[model samples]
Target: MELQLGVLGVGHLSTAILQGVFEHGVLDPGSVLLADRDPDRLEDFAGLGCPVVPSTELVRAPRILCAVRPQDFPAAAAELAPLGSEHLVISVMAGLGSDSIRSSLGGACRVVRTMPNAGAVLGCSMTAVARGPGATDDDDAFVERLFGAIGLTVEIDERMLSAATAVSGSGPGWVYLLASAMHDAAVAVGFDSQLADTKVRQTILAAARTLETSGQPFDQLIEGIASKGGTTEAGLRVMRENGFVEAVVAGITAARDRGDALGAADQ
Candidate 1:
């Protein structure tokens, strides 16, 4: 919701981010500034009504958002080093660390490290943010407002970011995977492709709503639909026999560990 928004990379994620900010009414097109070395990106931004400048100039804005690749972070930080103490930085890069940024930008400048999934483009994202070690409550609050504009905002420890990245940061893909599977299953069960697609979407939505509002235990909720000799129970037994629950647990754990590995790989 900050008017003085400066973005470092005008790539795919940056475009989605700017679009989300506008669609969510968090920012106006005229108020957002962007910078990137890529001419194609600048041209695209121009069409979107965003002011695209050189990367160095973007850093001069009061609040800068870094969306560049991890390898480009150091260079971007160097460009932002000239900014005054009043500047605040928000980074959504996967592998970059807040400490590296705070050390790069001088004085008591504010730093925010945030991880939001690609779903932010649709204003339905779960964003995790961690402020600088020295950032006051006000600093963190402002960041909460910013990220909340895109979706949900949860303030958590930077160390926990690896796990957060696995869950919220990569949650959209997991959801899509299930959606795809459900659609395919519907089609295999004699439903037309279009019907399967439509029904699967509604099914997913209804199931999510039940999970959201139902006070009953998850096991009880599932059991409510599945009779003692029903098809659902048969499927459930197959899943259990195949270690479905364990596989899911292992998958998320692997994702969390992969995130930690990516962040630390640079060091």
Candidate 2:
């Protein structure tokens, strides 16, 4: 059977996306085709019952998900060039823009660029999508629904994709760093490693759930926890004095600048 969805790469992010699609029943497993240079990666997907095909066969699918790293995209695009305007191309590669994909794959295809975090593996990612000139509202909706199966989806201007890449694409690593710090702090206070890990993980999960469900602003949430002269206030004050916020801002700015440089290279 001709595939409906084609995945060009089978790396971590692509695997997460494919897992979500399978878990959500978004597409029949038999109708999805996967391609990767790594034999182990191909075997992994083959075990899940997805056909491991060549890039030539995969790109024949009506909708293609380009999940290769930015450096690997040119070769994938060359393989996909025979596809025409009917194909809807969605790329999850950071630093690769839609114009470059269109140019590399022949200008006839519709392209949508997206950034999905590692949370996609757990169906909780915050995915940001942007459309190219050839895309239509239907194309936008299709991309949104495709990513939404794996997590929350938002539409943003293509110009802001680099900013989104910094925040959403790179944001998970930042959160993990903070989690590591919290775990270390807990251990310093005499908790065992297992206990500290459990507590820190639960705390972060609870905070994220509260933020999602509560209608309160982030500052209000923080204020609620940090009573005047309380322990939370003391800790927060120490963080502020140590330029924690400034450091975070600087990190995000660096990621965004790097993304800009990559985009420039593509252009």
Top candidate by lDDT: 2
- Tens digit per residue, CA lDDT, model 1, 1-267: 445778888887777777666666766776778888878877865776777777778765678888888888878778778666677888888877777677766655677788888767766678888876466777677667667776788888888888999988887777888789889989999999999999989988999889768999999999999999999999999979989789778888999999888878755
Clashes of each: 0, 0
lDDT for position 244 in model 2: 98
**Ten-residue region with minimum lDDT total, candidate 2:** 41-50
In angstroms, the error of model 2 at 119 is 0.3
* Alpha-carbon RMSD, candidate 2: 2.4
lDDT of 2 by residue, 1-267 (tens): 657788898889888887787778877778888888887987866877788888888766888999988888888888878668898898888887788788888888888999888889888999999988688898888787778888999899988888998998889899999999999999999999999999999999999899889999989999999999999999999999999999999999999898899889888
Which candidate wins on TM-score? 2
**Candidate 1 Cα outliers beyond 4 Å, as residue runs:** 1-3, 39-50, 106-108, 179-202, 209-217
Candidate 2: regions farther than 4 A off:
1-3, 39-51, 184-198
Residue 240 shift from truth in candidate 1, angstroms = 1.8
Query: How does residue 45 of candidate 1 score in lDDT?
Result: 56
Q: How does each model score on lDDT?
A: 0.79, 0.87
Q: Give every collision pair in model 1.
A: none
